[model samples]
Target: MIHTLSISELTVSRGERLLFQGLDLRIQAGEAVVLTGANGAGKTSLLRTIAGLLRPDAGEVAFHDGDGNPLDERLARGRETHFLGHQDGLKISRTAREELGFQCDWLGHVQCGMDDAVQAFGLAPLLDLEVRRLSAGQRRRLAMGRLVGSPRALWLLDEPMAPLDARWRAVFADQMRRHLDADGLILAAVHDPLPLPARTLDLGGLT
Candidate 1:
């Protein structure tokens, strides 16, 4: 099944400051779009809006099926999308194994391909350690386990590579490519260029 995200005439504001206005974008399956801009340029805001985490001041954000029919808002945001923000969203007290179990459940999977995810992220040895004991990069890997444990149609990532070392970053880049090859959609807010081919959109001109 193919899915597409459409954003039309979108406007967003934070407090008294206006972010972007009259923005439009369309992303189809097997595609990736990278959002780029200086700090406070609303890159994260755009991603959050599309993820249904924030209300847009104007316009519409919707998902369409391969046939061009719109999907229910609930299904679009809940079942089809995965949002990974800067914060790893891990409980410091939980062991990596416990957290991964919870993440797989929360992602609506029955621990499918979980072993593969552990191997892919090199998480076998770290699984017994508490999240607080994990380094920044380790925590990031643990948090990302959901991307493999359970697959979703769309991924919204905010600086996904920021915490990783060069090697893990390369691993994640390969994962993103595989996602695209499997007809998944990605919208990422990134400072550095993504290691794969992706369309770049700069969210400039804040007022």
Candidate 2:
């Protein structure tokens, strides 16, 4: 399997606080890596670093194609890899349908069905409702809908199951399994057990 992401001797610091030091991690295609740690253990920070939202103080994050050669030419890190943070990123005044349309437009081509996503997320009745009026779990479901249209090979999800109910969680687990089976990679920060074949990377142990 080709390594999609590689981190070498990564070190990150916020002010005087050391987030992580001398950390090395490599994630390959078709693999799912679960990031587990207590709150404030730098799990989100690590995800941000990988997503290129924050630069590490030291070390390199390299991307490779299926041939194992470096794919350093790619500029948009979030383009080829979807990063779903804890924040819903929804426009409060916008309706659910509008938000989905905006995300689809940003993603270029739409491979997934918007109606299907709304149905899957149980947002059919809330499609015309403004996001600000939705519950916390409903907002998360809407955010997860963004992934439906993504053509990305890697997914960086922070608390993906946070607002999902039991049924939706099961559906999401199935979706994750299908993603992995299709040679996609996932690195997620999860509090509960993820029902996928995943390798746990404890951020707290990196020090």
Candidate 3:
């Protein structure tokens, strides 16, 4: 009856090869879980599957709402969670403010105000600059800020710490910890240790 994200008997295949099979996971509120594996492992594939962007060859993923009832699948798959993939989804032509505002509107993130989002991400100085002019780390920071500004219960992050330097990495890691403290669930794929304590799911032994 508790709020949780459940994956049962998950089986995912990439073309002719089986990436993973008979996998299972359950994520409760406020928990952070990291998925660790090699390049060809099914970490990303599993994230895509859970995001409803990829279909698993078998098994199912579901989210239970606070009321102990399953959330509407349509809403859960599209809006209840934020999935940050390997590629940054940003418009090179748009300024940081413009881009973040557009994303907030697009995602219907009414609870997160524009000013609060900008300030939270320490992005005031970069607001007027076009995304194309921003450096790699700046762009990544903007993306991280955008995530903090947006409201969602679950976050699916793929290699989130890769673009960050030590300081920003710690900053974002702190943000992740804050998110978990707020009872948000996070599932990420990473090669290194997270700044905060986290439970890890290693895919090395899976056949």
Q: Which residue segments of model 2 deviate by more than 4 Å?
A: 1-3, 73-78, 111-113, 205-207
Top-TM-score structure, candidate number: 1
lDDT of 1 by residue, 111-141 (tens): 4568867988999999999999999999999
Pairs clashing within candidate 2: none
lDDT of 2 by residue, 23-130 (tens): 888888889999998888888888888888888999888888788888752443746777889897899999988997787667644555676567666778888999
Query: Please, what is the TM-score per model?
Result: 0.96, 0.92, 0.93
- What 10-residue stretch in candidate 1 is worst by lDDT? 107-116
Cα lDDT of model 3 by residue, 88-109, tens digit: 7989999998888887777656
**What is residue 198's positional error in candidate 3, in angstroms?**
1.1
| Greater-TM-score candidate between 2 and 3 | 3
Query: Local distance difference test, per candidate?
Result: 0.90, 0.81, 0.84
lDDT of 1 at 200: 91
**Model 1: residues with Cα > 4 Å off, grouped in runs:** 205-207
